[model samples]
Every structure is written in C-alpha cells, then in structure tokens.
Target: MPAVLAHAFAPHSHDSATKTDAALESSRHGLRALVISFAALMATAALQAVIVARSGSVALLGDTLHNLADALTALPLGVAFWLGRRAATRRFTYGYGRAEDLAGIVIVALIAASAALAGYQAVKRLIDPAEVRLLGLVAAAGVVGFAGNELVARYRIRVGRRIGSAALVADGLHARTDGLTSLAVVLSAAGAALGLPLADPIIGLLITIAICLVLKDAARQICHRLMDAVDPALVETAERILAGVPGVENVGAVRLRWIGHALRAEVEIAVRHDATLLQAHAVAVAAEHRLIHELPHLRAATVHADPDGPPGADHHAILSAHR
Candidate 1:
C-alpha cells in the first residue's frame, strides 16, 4: 500500500465539540459588540438629527446620515457572524464564512453611498448658500456623535482582533472614519460661527473625500480576506511547528486560510523514505497534533505525508507518469 495519505487532524467528537464551542464563543463576542455599538450609534444619530432639524446645518445632517448608516451596518454584520456559526453543508464545503466577506462588501457600498449623498448636499449648499443657525448646539451634537462612534470603534477593534475577524476590524475602522467626519462637523460649525458661511459646505465636501479614502482602505482589507491572504508570520509559525516534529525529515508546502474567524491549514511533510506505512502515519499525526496545540486559532489541518527522497510534487508526477 502507498505510504502517502491525507488526514484531517480532527477525528474525535470531543475535538469537534471543543471547536464548535470556541466558534460559538467567538460569535457571541462579536454579537455583543455589534449590539452595543448599534444602540449607541442610533442614539447619537437621533440626537444629532434633532440638532440638524433645529440648526439646518448641512454638515450636521451629513454626519447624522453617516451615523445612521453606521448603525444599520451592524445588522448585516450580525447576520453574517450568525451565519458563520452554521455547520458546513455538502453544497457548501466551507460553510458560511464567506458571508462575512460579503457583508464587508455591503459595508463598503453603504459607505460609498453616504459619501455620494454627502457630496451632493455639500455641492448644492455651495451653489445656493443657507445661513447655518445655532452654531454652538451643532458643535455640541458633533462632539456627541464623535464620542459615541469612537467608543464603539475601540470596542469593536479590540474584540475583532482578539477573535481574528477581518470583517469586524473593517467595521471598526469605518466607525472611526465616521467619528472623524463628525469632528469635521465641529469644524464646519466653527467656520460658520466665524462668519465664513461657505466653510460649512466646504467642510462637508472635505468630509466626503475623507470617507472615500476610508472606503478604499476597508475594501482593500476585505479583498485581502477574500483572496486567502494569510499573514506570512502565520505560515512561518506552521512551518516551524512541522519542522519540530521528530520524524518529519522535510517540510514541504504549508498553506493557511481564514474561514470566518477560524483558520485551517494544509501541510505537506516528508518522512524517511524507508519508513513503514505505520511509521509515516504516526509522524503525520504527530505533526498535525503539534500544529493544533501550538496554534490557538487553527481549527483544522490536513497533513500529507511523502517520502523524504525527493520533492513531493515531482516524485508524485514521475510515479504517476511512469504508471
């Protein structure tokens, strides 16, 4: 019998149970952050909308819309995280992890829409100027919006990093952008108070441009996740773990990708050419075990065993071609 085999490290129900529990725990953390942030944003936006009505600051109105969009974004992300908890199906071998990335795309679209709307209003205000009233109250509302968004941004970023969630991290960054634009509302209020009435709309235009920059960054992050780009350090760590396995003579290709917040790997290890099939299998298992033990986020690993005599692909190709 051929000594080469591919084995999934998870063979026991206990391991599956533990992994499922961990995934659920991660999802819970994300959900909690989303709920709190959404509520905070909604309250902040409502307060600011009241000010927008009373003061007629186009800049404040723009900030209010951004805050509302930010709050609504939590809904899709919450659903994505929930879907990510679902078990893999025959039709969807990787489960619903990709939904997180799709949610991220939706966020980017929403951000773009807010930018377009803000820019349009800003340009209209520039063409037909309006006196901004109650400048002090508008500034105060901007401060409130900034405070709420910054708090939510910090919480989401901290939890997202802990759980290894790219989508959540992007959302946090988006909130940070909104907070910064809220500060731009303060600047607009200040300019209006100083009698440069046109400054308010100009600041709104500038805020719109800044939002586009943030949108570019968030889209880049989401695209990287969709493209299966894991950190090089993670790949190095996997290789090191494989090398430390006693019977592994050589470490071949090592690949890691994130499915939602969890990571899975496919690794190739070379064992002694003269080793028995049982010995090779034992070596592969040991390597797999060490990988799972050392990498906290690694949920599953597929280890491929090959003879130590030559490179795995060339040897397999030569053997198959000869046969």
Candidate 2:
C-alpha cells in the first residue's frame, strides 16, 4: 500500500489550530514593523520637505521624494499582511499569502515612478540652473535623512528575514539605498558652497541613477519570489533531513515552495516492500514530523511513501502513457 500523508492531516505534528495561530502571529509582526517604519519615514520626509523649500536644493528635493514614496509603500505591505491572515478557501485554495507578492509588485512600480519623477526634475533643473540657498540647512537635513533611513532599514530587514518575507526584505534594501543617496544631497550642498551652481542638479541626477539601481534589484527579488524560487541551500537542507529519517530506504523527488511567508513541501520516500499499510503510514507521518520540526517557516509538508520494489519492477508504469 502506498501511504500518502496530506498537510492538513499530518499526524503527530502541529495541528491546524496551532498553524493558524502561528500564521496570525507572523502577520502581526509584519504589520507592526511596517507601521513603525512608516511613521519614521514620514517624519523624515516631512523634515526634508521643509529644508527643500528653504534651500531650493534639487538634490534634497529628489531625496525627499524618494523618502515619501518609501513611506507610502508601507500601505500595500500592511494590506498584504492583513490579508494573509485569512483562512484558505476552496476558490483560493492556497489562501491569501500571494497578496504579499502582489504588494511587492506595487512596491516595484512605486519605486520606478519615483525614479522617473526624480530624473525628470533633475533634467529640468539642469536646463534652468538656480542657486541652492541655505546650504548649511540642506546639509543638516541630508544627515538627518540618512540617520532616519538607516535605522528603519535595519529594523525592517531584521524583522523581514526573521519572518521569511521577501517583500519586507526588499523594502528594507530600498530604504538603505535611500539613505546612501541622502548623503549625496550633502555633497551637492558642499559643491554649491564652493561656488559651483550646477552641482545640485548633477547630484540630483546621480541620486536618480542610484534609485534606478535599487529598483532593478528590488524588482529582481520580487520576480524571483513570484516565480516560486527558493534558495538551493534550503532544498539541500530538506533533502538532508528527509534522508536522516528512520524507516526510509531512500529519498526521491523533493519539491518546496513559498506560499506567502510560509514554506510547503512535497516529498517522496521509499519504504520496505514487505511493510504493512500501517507501517508505511507510520513512516510517512514520521517524515512529515521531522520536516515541520526542522525547517524554518515550514507550515506543512506532504510525504508520499512508496514501496521499495525489486530492481526492474516499475511502480508507476501505469501512468507512463499519460506522461
């Protein structure tokens, strides 16, 4: 008998109620991170806006716009986290976890739009050069922007990685880039102080370029998540764990994927051909238990136990025609 253990009914493991509570806790952590970071960024942007108005620094203006956009990005991610708490339905059997991926898409779009707007503003300023006033205030504002963004970046990245959220990690990287570009605003202020009027717009253009680079990276990460790509190291770890399980002759195909921040696995293992149905079922349940306990963020796994038939015996030959 082929013993197949499904995720929902995997015995001797975390129950469905426990899984639901864990998921809700994870979502709450994500939402808390977003809210705090959003507040920090908004305050930073508001301060930079005041400085931009007084100093007329195009570089500072570009940096402020990026900060504002970064703050606004929290909205979609917060929505994604909230939606992820919903139970899986028949129509959407996988649940609302993919909403995080969609939020990542929206984040990428927002980044692209910010880059375009910043580039356009810089080019316009270059064509019509103007004096950047209050150089001291502009430099001070740049420093403040860097401090705020760096703090938020560290917090977001820490929580994101802990929760296995690709979107949150990407957003943290975005914030880090914004921090580096904020320093460029200080350089523009220095250039203006040295009597070079064109430095402000030139630095603005450079900031735009930096934003584009960040956009490329964030887009790549989000696209990879959307494509169901996981780390090769994780696959290796799973294989190793399954191979170490008792009563398994060999480990065969092992597939893994991310549904939201959680991981799901499908595994095939071989058992003794003479094993009774109860024995095969025990092995399958054991395999599932080992996987859920060992893997990080692994919500569930399905283990299919196959009989270790004699060497020339084909167990799946009947399905060969379909393939």
Candidate 3:
C-alpha cells in the first residue's frame, strides 16, 4: 500500500452540521461588531468635525479624518463576513474565506491614503501658520475622541480575538492608534493656549507619523495572512498530538493554514510496515480525531499514514517521476 489518507470531513454527519453552524455564528458576530463600532466611530468623527470647523485646528481635523476612515473600513469587512457565510461552490473548493484577506488589503490602502492626506495638511499648515481659535473646545473634543476610540478598540479587539480574525484585530489596533493621536490634539490645544504658535501644526505632523506607524503594522498583518502564515506553536502542538497516537511510529511533514479565521491541517505519520490496511486506516482516523479536538480553531484535518519501510527501501520511489 502506498498510503492511506483519512479526512475529518463527513458531509452527512451531525458533527459537520455543528461546525457549519459555528462558522455562521462567527460571521454574524463579526458583522455585529462592525456595525456597532461603525456607529460609535461615526459619532465621534462628527463631533470632532464640528470642533474642527469652529476652531480651525489642523491636528483635530486630521484626527477626525482618520476616525472617519477607520469607521468606513467596517464596510469592506462586513461584506467579507457575509461572503464568508456562503456555501462552497464546485468551482471554488475553498469557498469565500479569502474575501476577508482581500478586505484587509482594502483597509491598508485606506490607511495609507488617510496618512498621506494628513501629512499634506500638516506640512501646508506648518509653512503658513494659522491661528487656532476655540482652544477650550478643541481640547474637549480631543478628550471625547480618545474616549470613543478607546472604547471601540477594546470591543473590536475582544471580538476579533474570540473569532480568530486577523483583520478585525488589525482594525482594533488601528483604533487604539487613533486614540493616541487624539490625545496629541489636546497637546496642540495646550501649546496654543501657552506661547508656542507652531504647536498645533507640529502636533498635526506627529499625528500623521502615528498613522504611518499604524499603516505599517496593519500591512504586515494582512500580508502574513495572505501568505498563509500560521503560528509556529500550532505546528509544534500538532506534532506532539500525532506522536502520542497509538501505532504512529513517527510524525513527518505537518502543515497548517488559516481559511479565514478557521484552520485546516495536513499531516503525514509513519506506521509499522507489517500493519494491515485496516490498521493503518484506523490509526489515521484516530490522529485526525485527536487533532480536531485539541487544536484551537481547527475546522478539519487530513491525515496520511505512511508505512515504515526499511531504512534503505524508498517507499516513494514510484512517485519520484511525478515529483
């Protein structure tokens, strides 16, 4: 026998139905978070906009724009979650999980655009200094902005971690960055009230730099997801699980990848050459069972049982040509 491949998926089983329900529930949770966070952020931005118009504060204006952009990111992520709920079609074997990663790309682009706009506005104000009026209101708006963004950040990070969503987590981090920049606006107000006339524009430039840092972090996360990268600890855990299985002489290549927020694994294990086909199949099934139960967020796994032939005898010689 070449190898026995056992898959954890069984369409007609109750277990499969449960898994499907769980996936849909996760999508619903993602959409709910997006909607609530979106509303909160929009409200915060609107309040800031009013202050920006009255005070003519460049720093507050930049913070307001970033808040608006961050709120809009929810649109793409919401659509991605909805698409993820769709059933897999014949042409698309993996379903629409990849839509989340694509949404992440759009989010990164938006962050970059906001950063550029903020930078330009800051530089312009720096060249031609403008008097920032209503210093008190600007300071109050900054405090409000910080409060709102921090709340949204906490909520998003909580839900994102629960659902294993990289995009949502990245967005949450982005919101936290917005909160920090919003605090900078208060410093600008203080500088204006004191003696430094250039403090408002200088703070605006600092806010722009903060946005750039956030952009870099978000881009890195999205790129990792697109590249199918998983935590090394997951692989190590999988190997330990397989090695503990009865009749598994050795564990070979083990791979894990995220399909959206869920995980899928492929594993190879060596069994005694004298074992019968049924024995090998049983071992493969056991390994798959253990993996699914122990691995967090693992939706399914395919286990392959290879016969442990003599050291010099190459069992894969026949398939060498194909390779």
Which one wins on lDDT? 2
TM-score of 1: 0.91
- Cα-based TM-score, every candidate: 0.91, 0.95, 0.94
Candidate 2 lDDT over residue span 51-170, tens digit each: 898888989999999999999999999999999999889998879999999998999899999899999989999999999999999999999999999999999999998988878888
Candidate 1 total steric clashes: 0
Which prediction has the highest TM-score against the true structure?
Answer: 2
Query: What tens-digit string does per-residue lDDT give for candidate 3 at 1-323?
Result: 23333231111111377778888898899999999999999999999999999999999999998999999999999999999999889998878888999999999999999999988998999999999999999999999999999999999999998887878888998999999999999999999999788999999999999999999998998899999999999999999999999989999999998888778888899888878777777787888889987888777787877888867888789999998
Error of 3 at 208 (Å): 0.5
In order, what is each prediction's RMSD in angstroms? 3.1, 2.5, 2.8
- Every candidate's lDDT: 0.86, 0.90, 0.89
lDDT of 1 by residue, 219-246 (tens): 8888998899989999999999999999
Residue 208 in model 2: shift from native, Å?
Answer: 0.6
